[model samples]
Target chain A: QKEVEQDPGPLSVPEGAIVSLNCTYSNSAFQYFMWYRQYSRKGPELLMYTYSSGNKEDGRFTAQVDKSSKYISLFIRDSQPSDSATYLCAMIRDNYGQNFVFGPGTRLSVLP
Target chain B: DARVTQTPRHKVTEMGQEVTMRCQPILGHNTVFWYRQTMMQGLELLAYFRNRAPLDDSGMPKDRFSAEMPDATLATLKIQPSEPRDSAVYFCASGLTRQGRNEKLFFGSGTQLSVL
Candidate 1:
């Protein structure tokens, strides 16, 4: 199995709808979880970062990590058209200078 | 205002030619990473460096790809004898690592490469 798996979704939703994106990993050693957002023709940017098995919230976005199930999720509340982009789930084992394993991003389009 | 900078935002080269992509990471950030993004491969880590020394390059193809940090400010990824399959966007990111933990990464706009 791949180290990380994410559905390549072009999930469409109306504005103000709640959007949930998820990823599953097979590596139990993975410790740090991150979500990145990328716009068309732009590089990915860090959207959320979490280390523990819980939820971290920032404004309209929340990131949840469940180490027990090896699943992580990103929730966008009251989504806007500006939120349309690709979301990628990335993680790395706890270590010094270890490389990251990234999931295939889910493309999202928040309609007007 | 602090962000990673990459030059030659777009590059097109014939196969078998040498291609070099350059990055100027955020000052004071000691960790640099190179990643390639494609529809099929997603985002693949090509290599990464810490304190100007290569830490891992297992993700890179040894035959035609090489990455180096000749100095603190600059990192370069070179592909000699490039192939059409090498067409992808290359991104450079920098972060601060402390106490064996990686910090938030700041990314560049990326270099769009096309190998004909």
Candidate 2:
């Protein structure tokens, strides 16, 4: 099985709605969790970062990690059309210089 | 806005031809990485360098692929006798390492390669 799994969603939501994206992993060794955003024809950009099992908030975005359950989530409040993009979840071990493992990504669209 | 820079933003080549992609990492970053993205694989790390020395390249296909950091500013990924299966968007990323902390990576726009 793949170490990481995410729903490849083309989830459509209206503007001003709340959006939630998530991923699950089987590797308990993964300690660093991250979320990246990618627009069409562009490289992925880091959106949210969290360490271990806890929640981290940045403006309209909040990242939550539950290590025991091997699940991670990203929440977007009052979403906008500009927020339409693909969301990918990534994880890495605490070791230095280790490469990241990314999920398949979820495509989202916020309609105006 | 210092960011990783990749050359030949798009490449199209016939099968069995050689391909070379380049990257200019953000100045002062100590680590550089090469990655490929596709619908099937998502994003996969092909190789990485720390302090201008290769740390790991096990993810790359050794027979036809090579990665090198010729200097602090330049890194390259070359594929010889490329195949159709080698088509994907290749990305370069750089990070400033810190002990006991997770490094934040900044990625380049990437080179979209099509091996016909």
lDDT (10s digit) by residue, model 1, range A1-112:
8899999989999999999999999999899999999999998999999998999999999999999999999999999999999999999899767878899999999999
**Candidate 2 residue lDDT tens string, A1-112:** 8999999989999999999999999989899899999998888899997897889999999999999999999999999999999999998888877888899999999999
Candidate 1 docking classification:
high
DockQ of 1: 0.83
Docking quality (DockQ) for each candidate:
0.83, 0.64
lDDT of 1 by residue, B34-109 (tens): 9999999899999999999999999899999999999999999999989999999999999999997888887899
All candidates: TM-score = 0.98, 0.97
Give the per-residue Cα lDDT of candidate 1 at B91: 96
Fraction of native contacts under 8 Å reproduced by each candidate: 0.84, 0.53
Error of 2 at B49 (Å): 0.9
Best by lDDT: 1
The first chain of model 1 has a TM-score of 0.98
